[model samples]
Target: MGAMNTKVIEAEYDYVKPASLDEALDILAEKENVKIYAGGTDLLVKLKMGADLGMDIMMDINGIEDLYGVDKTADGGLRIGAAEKIWNLETNADVIAMYPILSEAMHLMASVSVRNMATIGGNFCNASPVADTVGPCMCYGACVELKSKKGVRTVDATEFFLKPGVTVMEADEILTAIILPAPEENTGAAFTKMARVRPDIAKVSISCVIKRDGDAIKDCRMAMGSVAPKPLFLGDISAELAGKKMSAALIEETAQKVHDFVKPIGDHGTTAEYRKEMAHLIAKEILEKAWENSGGELA
Candidate 1:
């Protein structure tokens, strides 16, 4: 519910804007209840709602030079600095050209103004069930790089979020970058979102990346959001469909399976039943689109 109808933050915390990643990590290692602040889109709202975060330090990593770059990785994959704003990704020529699915997802995000302030890392770290970008990230076979003074480790994007308002990242670990594997040749991807309003929080969303093998499905990654505590990566569904020939019957059957697998709650701007059904419908739509985009006609 609404904590109060106020615009002021009720919590007490020290704000730290570090100029480098090492400086940021050092602050985190020494502090407790260190909330990594970015964009301040969601965090500020919660604080204004009078949520007691028990905050000790608000570490702003935007000033950190190492946490702000977009470059191609060694394997031709893309490495996106965690602090990149969502709006920038939407307009990045390389990102738009190479991963149109992500571009589409970005466009469907909040209004242009909010997107300007929201960082990509902040969105994932926020760990909202209705987060629009998480499913697309998982579908692209992405990983999140986490760094602490102890060392650095990578967590698969699909595995990062443990629950709402929680991630596998420790209090001291910082999300350094998002590593996205290069899309295989002849592969196509698709994304769809359902919300009460355009550019609003998603009620239900799905994304898929498909590598086509002639008329058969060579491989695929599928995921959905707003239907679970964390984004649901359909590894089982993808495994089951891999190597299977594409057909209307197969798509219809998979949709039924999706509806059965999802466990959405009846809240967040829609009914559980509605989200469940939309998940099924979206799966079918994206399956066909991705297949067609990969230069094959769905039979």
Candidate 2:
């Protein structure tokens, strides 16, 4: 499917570049069989494969200045605009310092060239189960802002994706921004992935965020990707680990919980059983790294 498809993208669709969110929403509200064009990294590939053959209206919202940058919310969280490039997130000093897990995920995603052309919002809207950003975003307590002709609503990352290549987004909705809560003073986060290769889809990936109070885990959150239908958040497992002293035994128990909780599908890169196993391993590893970063020692 790579280069064999010779379809030209512009041949079938009427294009519109809306300069304002109001104009875009008006178009979306009025149009049927329309597709929102962001970075087009995944959209273009899907188009070439004829996945969206019936799509006749291509609404290019990239020109909307309101959806274009990362800013700080008054509540000490990050508001990442929908059209901000992946390359920007990877190299942005504020993003790197405050949200290193997001930076790590971005670094491990597609290639540098693809990242240059991909947007954070496009990645989420593409809704691939193995989307590298979703895992870390979930762990970081992120939410997405969706807008339509009606109004704007915020949805947590955990509740955003309905299934593979699907989301809670309505046909007329556009994801305007992603909001990430600032990490607490004692919190630390880490992300790890077991992919077939650097630039390929992850076989299994996990992100962990933990807050420590002296020697105990004060709070914890974990999210895993590519091992299930969508990125799975292990809130139960996180709760079990919280308030407990960090140790190899506790880590193993939590890892086992993760292994028991997920039901992964088998694919070329790994078997279902192997995916579950790696989920355990990577969960433990990332949790430990997060603990250590929060000033715990591996004893």
Candidate 3:
């Protein structure tokens, strides 16, 4: 193989690896053109792929004490530290049992080795159109906690991504943690992805969360990845299916609605039309599986 024609820029930043969130935020506020480095799984790859390198300061937050644990809040929601690895999320028994959508999504990401180093925050912060975590996180109604030198703020996952490679995060704010609400009683969530290869990034991915009340659906949330510029919530279809008994016809109808709502563009991985078709198929499959797991009728 020959050397690729990619520009290499020399590192010019004063590296600061902060041990605390406050310290990291302070550095961010004080430094000019500072970029936060988490696992660097995505950032480093983008840089190698010839992404623009414009930062003069690189602040490493992986060692920050305030952003390195997985615990439950007093209200019983899971609080995942921003620095927690995707592999840890895949294997965590509590996360597996309670947030199967997240577990499945994490398991479907790159590979075991990559997941071992990729943090959830990095996945969301990178804001890739096909990010595995975004779909599941949106379906679960997860919120991102961001901190700056002044204070902290939280934003829902559904609203985090503004466009491909863009988020609501400000330059001086670091994502501190991800907050996932506890699953409701009699609820189940599932995620499905389609790719040409087992470990490749998803061409189209869907995550469904359903809550059952007797034979009827009490709530349903569906999110799709890689089918739009950013992760999208299928709110219209969700509302249409709410309070309805699960059925093949209803599932197919809602799936079509979701398919119609998504606006995908042709890319190297897959065609736009193929993604549209897969989006419908994957959404139906995940919704049906979630309904069945939650003790709802599948017929």
Candidate 4:
């Protein structure tokens, strides 16, 4: 009689820490099976939980010098180096004042210690069902710049997610940076989340950006998290309010539309109906707060 092998794979085959993006891409292209490690917050935890035991190699990109800073683009947009930690983005005054929605979303992420070690790139790459940054970034019209040995390509954050824990990133591609367009003049954004407690993953979250022209709503963008396979945009609802004067009735109508747009599934943390209702309430509240912050106009 012959016995079958029962040993389980417990760790990675090889590890490499590359000092440059080009070097990393070369390794990724040559390696048969490799995973990129960024902040290591999400990846490490998943590894420890036996999530990636089949991964044969790990390529650590944390040492790449070019991917660790925050800079402004020539077009007045903000370019966030992929390796920039969430804590830095949350506390940096320039980011806070310019992209308040991003700052707010970062602050609402995991605990302070996790935020210090978590990179924005890692957050997007992890592709969690309810990733906090995805909704806000999508609403703000952010794009991710991915680099590979072949070349570089940009993908809008809204289209980045294909499904839960899935993105458009190719095997040899690495996300290099996130680019956020500057908010329009007379524009403001607000993010609202409902969780069981502080530091808890959001049960549902909503982000809204509104631009005002005099006393009328000029444009609006709205997004929601934890309500679908990925974060969702309420463009239909936003379009309906364009050029309309902001009022309590208008806000409530928009909120109801948002409520109808989400198709949340029941999960451990919340019921689908609860999430739908909360999303409506939060969307309305955020719109009101953003309107007030924009000086009762549409800033």
Candidate 5:
């Protein structure tokens, strides 16, 4: 009789649950190859796939109280704790009333069960090009607050992502919260996407925010995902559309501008040409909805 040899899987790395933000920061500053663990929805999958992340220790910040709530800031903006679950934000009273565009994107991501396990901070930190939340957050003028033992610093969400699965976060810094400014009086925002199915990732997604003054647009902001290496915030194009009256011809021109500017990469999910077309289509729909919400009638 012959005996066969089999491979034994061994779990590597140590796990730490810090009691406070200070403790977490201290560990992060001192530990080598430290990876922050929040919801683990994305990180765990990467680890299983043997992504060369160089992680040797996983620091879980779930127990830190400061990283766990959705609160209103003094300036009427919302400060969302890093460890707050997606499900919490999806149903939070203030989040729904104040930033429903963000809620709309969150509601369309994954499934209910995955939402329960995913954290908003984790989503941003993962830096997926197709991350649903990033575009909404970008449209709303969000900022990310990062803390380490040294001190705390903030960066605009528009400047957060460097590329897919990469952010500007330093090794010792932890993303503590996401700060979203209050929507202006005349402003309205909306998010829409085209996906293979309800639960699938978007082929192209757009989030638009606009401010209307009588019959003319006072300002415009738009962000798109799955059409670039990172979420693309169309600042120049938005500037071009500002003060323009909303009309079918203008919308067509805006869509054309979007298609011309964005160069998305093709993958197994879709072709680059198809994604470019959908980027235009989704942007038009998002802009129309946002304009209507701002009390403008589509022409």
Candidate 6:
């Protein structure tokens, strides 16, 4: 077990820094109980809190050349390096212009210093239910690429999370990048969260994306955080509004459905009942805002 009751890491562990993607995969394949270190905003906190990671080696992925920078794909999509700093993504030009909701969420994710040291991959892999980026990423139809010595595979963001602090990644697999598809024309997204302060973990969070087709909802994706084991993707609920005309009555009815749908237990300094209520309100708030962005007015 790691040393407990301290605000600093005292455990003895060998740290390895790989130069390239292949080199990192080789180490991951060959090593036992190896943990990937990127940015270390979350991992370092765990170590300081004496959370037993049960690892023998810590692999620092920051040095890998392939795991840096964001690039636009040929199809007007984007490929975000897993180790790209949160600060960069929060302010990236393409992100701001193309995926505005994601950029907006990252801006409020944490304080400037922590964002400077936090990696997007590390943030997703940390698997916090209320992670600001994950909800927005999923809302935008993102996918995460998992690479390993054996090969690579892609998992849709909508299908990624299994539970709190857990993903479907294998032991030898490393999340190399996050890919986002081009948004359909007339599409818009909105994000909001409720926290105790300006810079605090969320008590409840919600994100919504809507593709408008002449004032009717052509398609929609909605997600709520801190109200379930993972960020709850309201696919079925979203489907209920697809191809339907926008109206205040419809939004209000769907909000009530959402209030009954989510199962929040309230572990983050709040009560279950409070989270449930806030989840409902936040859902309604984001949904209404997203509808407005999609060129609709409640009437």
Cα lDDT tens digits for candidate 6, 51-88: 77987899999878888779998998999999999999
Q: Judged by lDDT against the true structure, how good is candidate 4? A: 0.84
| Model 2: residues with Cα > 4 Å off, grouped in runs | 1-11
Consecutive 10-residue window with the lowest summed lDDT within model 5: 1-10
TM-scores for every candidate against the unseen true structure = 0.97, 0.95, 0.95, 0.93, 0.95, 0.97
Residue 210 lDDT in model 5? 91
lDDT preference between candidates 2 and 3, better one? 2
lDDT tens readout by residue for model 3, 71-170: 8888888999999999998899888887887988898899888999999999999999889998888888899999987798999998899998899998
| lDDT tens digits by residue: candidate 4, 1-299 | 12322253356468889878889989988876788777788877766656644678888888698788888888888999998999999998878888898899999898999998899999898888688887778877899999989999999998888888889999888899999997778887899889989788999998888888878888888888888987777778888888999998889888888888788999886899999889889988999987776666433
The lDDT of each candidate is 0.87, 0.88, 0.85, 0.84, 0.89, 0.88
Best by TM-score: 1
Candidate 1, residues 157-226: lDDT per residue as tens digits?
9889888888898988999899998878889899999887896788889999889898899998899988
RMSD of 6: 1.5
lDDT of 5 by residue, 1-299 (tens): 12322232133888899999999989988889999989988987766655657788989888799898888899999999989999999999999988888998999999999999999999999999999999989888999999988899999999999999889999999999999997788788889988889999888899999989987899998999989999888989998988788898898899899999999999987999999988888878888889889888886
Note the residue pairs that clash in candidate 5: none
Candidate 1 error regions (>4 Å): 1-3
Q: Clashing pairs in model 6? A: none
Tell me the lDDT of model 5 at 119: 98
Tens digits of per-residue lDDT for model 2 on 6-35? 457534789899989999999999989888
Best lDDT among the predictions, by candidate number: 5
| lDDT assessment of candidate 6 | 0.88
- Looking at candidate 4, what is the lDDT of residue 205? 91
Stretch of 10 with least lDDT, candidate 4? 1-10
lDDT of 6 at 240: 90
Candidate 4 total steric clashes = 3
Candidate 4: stretches off by over 4 Å? 1-9, 297-299
